[model samples]
Target: MAVLSKQVAVPKSGFSPIPVIDMSDPESKHALVKACEDFGFFKVINHGISAELVSVLEHETVEFFSLPKSEKTLVAGYPFGYGNSKIGRNGDVGWVEYLLMNANLDSGSGPLFPSLLKSPGTFRNALEEYTISVRKMTCDVLEMIIDGLGIKPRNTLSKLVSDQNTDSILRLNHYPPCPLINKKTNCGKNVIGFGEHTDPQIISVLRSNNTSGLQINLTDGSWVSVPPDHSSFFFNVGDSLQVRLIS
Candidate 1:
C-alpha cells in the first residue's frame, strides 16, 4: 500500500501520446517492440473490434454486475465465476467484483450470465461475440510479440502460450467507488478499489470504461497512472512474458 510520488503524465487532447499503436498499420510492429521493451505495456488503437459491439459488451457487463448479490451467487464458482476479493482470506479486500471465465475461441464459451438472463436478449450473444473478438486480438498481439522477439510464430513459445486449449482467462472487473475514500484503515492505507498486482497470464488485453484507475510500476520504482480512454485497449505483458523475455 506504499504510494509513489512521481506520476506519469496523461494526455488530455485528441489522442494519448503514451505509446498508442494502431494495429492496422504495418509500422506499428516496431512501436510494439519498443513499448514492450521499455514499459512492458502499451495502448492499442484501430483494433478490429467495432464501437457498437464494445458498447453492447459494456452495457451487458454493467447489467450483469448490477444484479443482486444473492442472484450473482448462483453462477459463482472457484476462480472461474463471480468474485469480489482481490486477496482471498486476507483482512483487506479491494472494492472490486469480477466475473472470470475461459475465453477459448474454439469452445465458443462466454461469461456465465445467470440462467434467469438466458431469454431472448443481446446480453449473452454480445458477450460471446466480444469474447471471440478479444481472443483473436489477444492472439494477434501475441504473435506480434513473438515476431518482435525474432521468434517464429510456429515456435514453441508461441505455440505453447497461444494455443487455443491453453488456460486463457477473460476477467470482467468492476471496481465500485469506495465509500470511505477519505478514511484510512488500521494499516494507514486508503481503501483500495483494486490492489496493485501483476497478472499471471502471458499477457493481458484490458479495455476499461473512462473511469481511470489503472497504474503501472516503472522499473525505477515509480508508479504511473494509465488514464482511461475507452477508445483503446491496454496491453500488459504478464509474469510469464517477463520470465520469457529475461530468460
Candidate 2:
C-alpha cells in the first residue's frame, strides 16, 4: 500500500475538486444530480458498507492474486473469470490484472476457484457478502439520483439494478508496480494502468486501495487526478444514464 507518484498533468489547483456527497443527508439528492450533470462522477460517504466487510474481501482478493500464476490461471477465462493484461477482445492491454464475476450468481453456486486455493470457502463467502453490500449501496445511490431529477416513481432507476435478473458485474483490478523503463527516455512516466474509457453501463461504482492513480476527464476537457479515499465509494454516470437523461 505504498503511495506511488504519477507522472501526468494534474489540475492547476493541485487537487481534485470532485464532488463529495453524503448519503445520509436529505439534501444530498440535488447535489448528486449536479455532480452527474457537471462531472458525471462523485464520491459517496456515509454509505453503510462496513469497514470489516471491506477489509475481509480485500484480504481474500489479495491472497488470490498472490497465488502462483499457474494456480491463479485455474479460473482464467474471458468475460467472466480471471484475465491478465489483455483488455477485451480488442488488442488493448494495460499494466493490470483483474477478476470479473457475475454479481447475480446464487450464493450457493460455489467458488470460482474451489480447488485452487487453501481457503476457497472463505474467498467465496467474502465475495458474496461484499457484492450484496455494494449492490445495496448502488441502489440507494440510484434512488437518490431519481429523486433529484423528480422522476416519476422513485424506483425508476433503482429497480433496474435491484432486480433479480439484473446483469451486474463485479470487477477486481490489481495494478502491480512495474520498474521504470529508461527513466530519461520515458519521461519518468509509469505505463498506463488502463487506457481512457467510458463505462457503457447505466452506472459504475468503484472503490480502491489508498494508492492513487485514477484520473477523470472533466466536461471542460481537462483531466484531474482523483484523490484516493479507500473508505468512500466513487460513482460514475455511464453512457446509458447520460443518454437517458437527454432523452
Candidate 3:
C-alpha cells in the first residue's frame, strides 16, 4: 500500500522540485518520462477520477476500519482479507491494520469480497465503483508511461499489464494514532506506522489522508518528506516496471 525508495539523486541538469504533472497537459508525456527517469515517483493531477468519488471512497474506508474489531475479524485472512500487524510472527509490529481486495474481480480466482461484506450492498457498491475507476486510471497512466518510454507499439505495455487473468491488489491501510505520543512517555522504543520497503508490483498508486508521514530517502542519505495532497494521487514506479523499461 505504501512505497518507499532509497536514495537516488535527481540529476542536477533536469531536476523537478515537486515532480507533479497534470495529465491533461500536452507536454505531460515528456514530463512523465523525466519524472520516471529522474525521480521514480510522481504526483498526478487531472487523472479523470472525480473528486466526489474520491471523497466517497475515503469516507467508506474510514467507515470500514471503524467497524467493531470482532466484525472485522470475520474477514481476517492473510494477504486476502482484513489483517492486523499481529498477523506477522515477527516480534516487531506496526501500528497499522489493512483490508486487501482485488481491484479486478474477473482476474481474481477467489471471491472478490469477504463473506461479511458480500451482503452489504452499500459497501460493495462503493468499493466496486472506486476499484473500477482506479483500474481505468492505472491503465491510462501505464499507457502514458509506455509512450513516454518510446516503446514501439503503444499497446505493448498496456497488454502486458492488463492481462484479464492478473488481479491488481488494492490494499486499504489505516495507521492508528500512537497513544504514547499523548502521554509523552519516553518508551525508548520506536513506533513505525508502516515499515520502509519498496513495492514489488509493476506500479503502485497511493492516496492518503492529508497527513504528512510519507518519506522517501534522498541521494544524500537523508530522508525527504512527501507532503500530503488530498487532491492528487502519488504514483510509484515499482521494480518490475523499472526492469521492463530498461530491458
Candidate 4:
C-alpha cells in the first residue's frame, strides 16, 4: 500500500471547476459535448432517477458490506462479485473494496451471486431496479452527446449500450475511512484508494457518499478533486468513447 503526504489532498473551495449539466434541458446538449471535449467529466442534474431507489440500494449496500468477512466471501469471484483491496489483475492495490455485477444478466449470463447475500432476493431486486434506471439515463446522455456532435442517427452511440448483449457493468465501491497518522509529524499521510486510472468503457457513471476523494486529471495534466454530491451522478468519457469519436 503506497502512502502519500496529506499535502496532496486539495481542500474544497466555494467554487468548482467541474461542469454541471442539466439533463432535462435540450440546450444542455451543447454544454455536455463541450464538457466532454474539455474535461471528459461532468456532473449531471435532473437525470430522472428516483431518490427513493437510490436510497434503497445504498441501504442494501451498507448492509451487505457490514456482513462478516466470511459471509461476504461467499460471493467472491474473479472479475465480478466481491473484490477487496486488490483491483484487477494488474497488481494495483487500493484502500477500497467493491461489488461488480453484469448490467444485463437476463441474456442468460446466469445468477451473479450463487449463494451469498443475507437477503438475496431483496438485494437482487434493488440491483435490478437501479440498473434499469441508470442504464436508461446513460443511453439518454449518449444520444444527447451524439446529437450535439451532429452525427447521423443519434442512436448510433446509444444503441451500443442499449443492446441486450451489451457488456455494461454496475460497480458499487466502498472506501473505508483510514485512520489519521501520527500527531508528531503533523503532516498526515493518506492511503491510495483505487489508485489513479481512467475508465476504459464507453462511459462511467458514478455517485458516492458525502466523503470526497474522487479526482480527475485535466486536459493540462493537473489533478482536481471533485466535490461529492450524493444527489447527482457524475459522468466521465471513457477511452472507448474517445476511440469511437475519433474513428
Candidate 5:
C-alpha cells in the first residue's frame, strides 16, 4: 500500500543571525552570500517596513476576513479563491484564508489584475501598500541574490519578468488553531493546519509569529519548521526561481 509521506522539522535554536545587511559593508555582501548558499532561507530583521504600515496591513487583513462569508465570496473566483487561495496539501491551504494579490508589472494599473483589489478601502489600501512595499523588498533581495550567486550585479533574476523590471505578489494567510495535540501525518489523529507541499513562489515575505502552522519538506523525509518572525519577512526562492537558477 502506498501512503503519503510527511515529516515536519521543528527548528533547533542554533542559527546564523537573522541579517539586516548594510549595503555599504563590503563584507556584508559576502556574509549574505554565504547565508543564502548554506540555507536557502533566512530572516531579514531591520528590513524597514514601518511599524505603522505593518499595523495597517494587519488590521485590514483581519477586518477584511471578518466580513460576511458572502462578502468574501464576492471575489471568490479561483478555487476557494475569494481573495484567498487554498494551497495544495502541498500548496499551503487546508483550513486557512489567505490574501493573493499581484503587483502587476505587465498590467498598467495594479487594479487591472482583479475586481476584488478595487472593491473598498479596507482591503484596497493595505493590499496596495503591502504589494508595493513587498515588491521593493523583493527586488532588493533578488539583486542581492544575484550578487550572492556571483552573477553580474545587474543580472535579471527573471528575464521577461516585466517592464517594471520585477513583479511581486502577495499571499497573506491565516491558520486558525488546529485541535490536535499528538498530531502526526496519518497516525490516526485529528490535526491539521495545511496539507504538505513546497512553496512555488519566487519569494515569500510573510507576516506571522508563534502560531506555528507553516512547515517545509526537506529531502530527507522530514518537515522543517518555518521559524515565525513577525518583524522580518522570510525569503525562499520558489520552484520558478529554482528552475530559472538551475537552467
Candidate 6:
C-alpha cells in the first residue's frame, strides 16, 4: 500500500554501521559486502556526485516546498497517496513533503510526476542540470554496489534496475514541525524518525532538507539516525535487495 514497505524497528543491534567502501584499494569490495550482509545499510563517501550539485539540489528543493501546497501538489504523489498530502494520513506526516523527478529520459515514464519534474521534453534548463547530475550519481552507485557484491556475468544490478521499473523521481519531502514532535526529537520523531520503511524504489538517493527525522533500523532494536551528511548520498539495501539476500 505504501511506496516504502514497513519494517519492525525494535530489535537489539540498533544502528550498525556498514563498512565504508574505500573503492581506492582491492580490499574495499570485501569490506563493503561484509558490511552490507551484516547491517544492510551504509554511508557512502567518494561517491562521484559533486558537492556543488548537492547544494544546488538542496537549494531547489527548499525553493519548491517553500511554495504553498496548491502549487506543490502539481508535481506528484506517493503510491497510496502519502508523499504530498497532510501527515496523519501517513503516520503523522513526518513533518515533510516531497516531489519525484526521474532522471532517465526514456527509461522512466509518467504522470508519476508533473509538468515541472517531468518536463523532460520541454527542458527547463535548471531542472535539466539537476537531473543530469543526480542521474550520473545514481548510476555510479549502482555500479559500485554491483561490483562490491563480487557477482558477475549475471549483471544482477542491471536486472534489478530494469526489473524495479527503475525510476529516479527526485522526492522533494517536507517535514512540518509539530510542537510535540519538536520536543520529542528536535522536531524529529523522538529518534524514531520516519519509522523504518524500506524503499520500494530500486534506489532512493534521499537528499533531504537540513531538518531532522530519518533513521534506519538495526537488529538490536535501536533506530539510529543517519545524520545528514552534506553533499553526500547515503545508500542502503532496499526491500528487494534484502529479499534477494534472504533466499
TM-score of each: 0.82, 0.89, 0.84, 0.87, 0.71, 0.69
For candidate 1, write residues 1-247 as lDDT tens digits: 2222222344343232457888898667777877766667788888998889999878778888778889887877765777876544453468888887776634645435646454426876776688778777776777777777777633445465456687777778887756656444545356667777777667778888998777776545655678888888988877777777667
The order by descending TM-score is 2, 4, 3, 1, 5, 6
Residue 169, candidate 4: how far off, in angstroms?
0.4
Minimum summed lDDT over a 10-residue window in model 6 is located at 1-10
Cα lDDT for residue 164, model 1? 67
lDDT of 2 by residue, 1-247 (tens): 1111122344666565778999999799999888877667889999999999999889888988888888878888767778888889985777788888778757332236655777878888888888889999999999998999998898998888888877888889998766654666885385778877878888999897898888886544566788889999999888888777656
Give all candidates' CA lDDT scores.
0.70, 0.80, 0.71, 0.78, 0.54, 0.53
Kindly indicate the candidate among 4 and 6 with the higher lDDT.
4
Which is superior by lDDT, 2 or 5?
A: 2
lDDT of each residue in 1-247, candidate 6, tens digit only: 1222223344354544434665345455666565556666656667565676556555655565566667556644443222543433456434446554455444544333324433333333445666666666555556656677656744566544434455445445555544555564555445332444556555555554455555765554456666676655566666676665454
Give the per-residue lDDT digits (tens) of candidate 5, residues 1-247: 0012121233454222333555444455565555444444556655657777878777766666766667766655443244443553435446666555456523442332234333456556666676667666666667777776778745476332324644455555666544444346544254455565445656555567555545544434444566676777776646666564546
Off by over 4 Å in 6: 1-18, 23-26, 75-93, 105-127, 159-165, 179-193, 208-211
Model 1 misplacement above 4 A = 1-17, 86-92, 105-112, 118-121, 154-162, 182-189
RMSD of each: 5.0, 4.9, 3.8, 5.0, 6.1, 5.6
Which candidate leads in TM-score?
2
lDDT of 3 by residue, 11-80 (tens): 5543336588888885688888777766678899998888887787777778777778898878777557
Best prediction by lDDT: 2
How do the residues 48-161 of candidate 4 rate in per-residue lDDT, one tens digit apiece? 999999998898888888877787778787776788989999978887788887898575453456256667778778888998999999999999999999998999988988
RMSD of 2: 4.9
Q: Name the regions of candidate 2 deviating beyond 4 angstroms.
A: 1-14, 107-111, 180-190
TM-score of 5: 0.71
